[model samples]
Target: MTTKKQKSNSESHERKGVKRFESTTKGSSMIEFISKSETIFLTSLLFVIRLAAATWGIINDCDEVYNYWEPLHLFLHGEGFQTWEYSPIYAIRSYFYIYLHYVPAVIFTHMGLSKITVFTLVRVALGIFCLSGELYAYRAISKNINNTTARLFIFFTMFSSGVFQASSAFVPSSFCMAFVFYILGAYLNENWSFGIFCVAFSTLVGWPFSAILGLAIIIRMVFVKRHILAFIKISFLSGLCIGLTQLIVDSYHFGKPVIAPMNIVLYNVLSGPGPSLYGEEPISFYIKNLIVNWNVAIIASGIGFILSLWPSIGRKNQKGVTEYVSPIVWITATTGLWLLIFWKTTTQRRTIFIPNISIYCIFHCTYL
Candidate 1:
C-alpha cells in the first residue's frame, strides 16, 4: 500500500545514506568508522582539555561562587556565603544538587587533599560528567546521522570558548546543559525511556526551566508517534520518583516542606518583580554574548533553522510519509521558540546556555 511519494522519500533517504557513507569513507580517515582505540584516544584528549578548563577557566558570574560553590562549601566546611534564595522562606534553590557535588568533594577531602585541591577536583568531576554526555551525543550522532556531523560536533564542542566558560561551572544551567546532551542523543536514537527520565531529572534536580527543551520529545511521542500510553507511564513514573527525592532532600535542608522546583518557577515566572529586580537588558545582550561565544556558527544556526523548516512544512500534508515533520524540525523549532521567549524578557547569558547547546545540533541539520 506504499504510495509513490512514500517510496520516493524512502529511496531519497537511502541515497543520502549511501552518499554519506561513501563520502565519509573516502574523504577523511579521521571520520571513518571509529574503532575502540580511536574512541579511547578521543576521550583522553577531550578529558585533558576539560580538566584544563576546570583548573584555569575564570569564573564569569558571581552566581557561580555565591549561589552554588559557596553553598557546597558550607555543607563541607560549616561556613560560606549564604544567598537569599537559600533562605527557608524562599527556598528557590535545591540542596539536592549541592549534595550531589558534595560526594566528590568529600571523597577528595578524605584523601587528605587541601580545600583548594578539593574544589578543583570537584570542578574536574563536573567536567568529566559533562564530557560523558557529549560522548554519548557524539556516538548517537555518528550512528543515527552521519560521521561528518559527529566529527564536527566534537570539534566545535571542544574548541568553543563557551564550553570552557560553562563546562565545569558549579551551576544549575551548566548541569542542565549536560542533561541536554543526553536528551538530544536519546531523542535522535529513539531511546524513549532514557530520554523521558533525563528530562525529569534535569527539571527536578537541575533547572526547572530546562523542561522546555523536552517539548520536542513530548510532541513526537504523544502526537506524532502516538505512543500515548508509554509516554504517560514513563513520564509519570520518572517525575514522581525524581520529584519525591528532590522534595525530601530540599525540605530537609530548609527544615520545612518545600517544592524547590515549583517555588523557583513561581518566583521567576509569576512573581511581580522577578528577575527584573536584579536588572534588565536589551535583546542585544544575548546577541552580543552569542556572537562572542559562537561567532559565525550563530549565523549559520539561524540560516539552517530557516532552511530546515521548509522540509517539515512541505511534508505536513503528505499522506504516506510516516513522520510529517522531521524530528530535526521539532528540535530546531523548539530552540527557536525558546529564543523568542527569552529574547523579549529579561534574559541572562547563563539562562541561555541550555538553548545554546542546540546550536551545534541545528548546524548539523543543515547538512541533512
Candidate 2:
C-alpha cells in the first residue's frame, strides 16, 4: 500500500512538471518584446515611407520595364515590348511570375482605374509585401537575438536608398530579396518547414539562383539539427507543388511543356556564353554601388563582421566540431560566397544584397 501511494505521487509530480514547462515555454514565445503601440507606430511609419517610394520611385533598370512590366502589360493590354527571353524557343522568363501581378492589374482595370493609378497600386502592393517580410524579420531578430538588434534592423531597412528602390521594384531579384527576409526570419524562429517552403518558393517562383542563399539553413537542418528526413520531405513537397504549377502555367503559355526555372538555371549556369554575354564589370563596381547605397553602415558592418569572428571562431559544440559555431558564421560564409560568384557578372546589383543589409545591421548592433 505504501509503495503504491508513493508511485502515484511520483507519477503525478512528473506530469505536473511537464505541464509547467510546456506553459512556460509557450508563454515566453508569446511575450511581446515591444509594446502594441510601438509596433503600430513603426508599421505605420514603414508603410508611409514605402508608399511614398511606390508613388514616386523611378524605374532605375530598363530590365524592370521590359522584362517584367512590359510582359505584364502585354498580358493585360495586348500590346507591349517582348524580350527575346520571352520567345517560345527560349521560354526563359516564367509567365507564372508575371501572372501574379496580372490578377491585380485586371482587377484595377475592371475598377476603371487609370493605367498610371493601376501602376501605383501594383507598386503599393509590392511595398506591402516587402513591409510584411521586413516586420517578420524584425520580430524574428528580437526573438532570436535581441530587441536592440531588431530595432537597428528596422532603422536600416526603412531608410536605405537601395531598399527604397528594391521594395517596390517588379523584378525577380527584388522579389527574391523580400523572400530572403522571410527565409531568414523563418530559420531564426526555428520554423523549419516554413523556412524550407520559402527556400523552394523563392528559388522556383522568385529567383532560381537564390537557392544558394538558403544553403546555411538547409545545411544546419540536415547535419546539425539532424532533421534530414523533415528537410527532404518538406523540400520535395514544396518543390513539387511549385514546380508543377510553373510547368502547367508556363506550358499553357508557351504551347509546350516547359520548366522556366530550370531553363533559366541551365542557360545562366551551363551555357557557354551565360550572363557574360550581356556585359561585365570590375570588382570595384559592387563596392562603389554599396558605398553609395549603404554609406558608413557598410563600413560598420565590416567591422562587426570582424568582431563576430572573435567570439565564434574557436567555438564548438558537444561533438567538438568547429562547424557548430554561431549561425551568423554560416550565414556570413554563404553571403560571401554569393558575392564572390555574383561579382564576376555584370548583372549583380546592390538590390541583390538587400537582405544582407538587414544581416549587417544585426551584426552592427550585436557586436558593436
Candidate 3:
C-alpha cells in the first residue's frame, strides 16, 4: 500500500512540472509577440507623422521651389547636366539641396511620383533621421543617468518646437538637425568610421553649419581625453579627411566650395546688417518677431529654458551629473548670443527661424 501511494504522488509531481514548463513557454511567446507588435505600431505612427508633415509643407510651399523645378525637370528628362540659364539666380545658393532633388525628380518622371509623394518621401526620410539622433542621444544619456529620465528627455526633445518646425516646415534645417544628432552619437561612442560617414553625409545634405555641431562634439571629446595631444591629432586628421572629400565634390560641381545657406545667413548677420536688414535694428526686434510668429513654440521653449536653469538654483549639495548640464547650457547660450547679435544688426526677420527653432527644441528637451 505505501509503495503504490508513493508512485501516485511522483506521477502527480511530474504532471505539475510539465504544466509549469508549458505555461512559461507560452508566456515567453506572448511577451515576444507583444514587443514586436508594439515596435511595429510605433514605427508606423512615426512614419505617418513624417508623411503628413512633409505633405503639408510641400503643398503650402510649392511656390518656393518653382524656380528650381524647371532645371530639376530638365535634369530629370536628361536634357543636359550643364547649368541652366536661370540656375544662377535660384539654384546658386543651395546647390547641394538642388542636387538631392535630382533623384526625386527622376523618380517622379519615371514612376509617376507626384509632388506630394516626393515630398512625403523626403519628409519621412528626414523624420527618421531626426528620430534616430534623438534615440542615440537618449541612449547615451541613459547610459550615464537614470533610464526613465533619459527617455523622458528624449521624448521632449523629439517633440520640441525646434524639431517639429524644422522637420515639418524647414527641410534644410531638419536635415541639419539629423546630422547633428548622428555626429553626436558617433562621437560619443568614439566610432571614427561612423562619425566620418555621418559628417560626409551631413555635408552632402547641404548644411555646412551642421558641421559646427559636429565640431562641438569633437571638442567635447578632446576636452575629456587623458591625452590632449592624441585627441588633437585625431581631430585634425578627421577634419582634413572631411575637408578633402568636400573639396573634391565641390570641384566636380560648382567652381568654388561653398558653405550652406544658413552659414551664409550667419555670416551676413555677423558682417553687420546687409540689405536684408532694412537698417540697424535692435536685438529686441528679432526676439519680438520670434514671439509673434511662433507663439506656441516660444511659450513652450520659455518654460523649458526656465526649467533647465531651475536645477542650478539653490541646489548646492546635490551630488549628480553636473557635467551633463554644461553642454546644454553652452549650446543654448552661444546660439542665443549669436542670434541676438544678428537680430541687433539685421532687419531680415526670417533669420530668426533657425535659432528660435533650434533653441526651442533644446529648451523643451531640457525642461521636460
On residues 97-185, what C-alpha lDDT tens digit does candidate 1 reach at each position? Answer: 89999998988988999999998998899899989988998888777666777878888788877677678989888888888888888
lDDT of model number 1: 0.81
lDDT of 2 by residue, 279-312 (tens): 6667888888777776776677677777777677
Tens digits of per-residue lDDT for model 3 on 1-368? 56988999999999999989978976765454345564465456555655556656443343234534444545565453443322432223454455565664466547877755665565565566666675665554444333454545555554555455556443455565666565555654566556656665665444444454455454545563334666566656765675565445434555554444434555454554443544555656767766765556557766767666757544422234235444455445545555645555565444335523433444445545
Which regions of candidate 2 are displaced past 4 Å? 1-34, 313-323, 346-351, 354-357
Per-model lDDT: 0.81, 0.82, 0.53
Sliding window of 10 residues with minimal summed lDDT for model 1 = 359-368
TM-score of 2: 0.86
Looking at model 1, the pairs that clash are none
Better of 1 and 2 by TM-score: 1
What's the TM-score of every candidate structure?
Answer: 0.87, 0.86, 0.62
> Candidate 2 clash total?
0
What is the Cα-based TM-score of model 1? Answer: 0.87
Ranking by lDDT: 2, 1, 3
lDDT of 3 at 102: 64
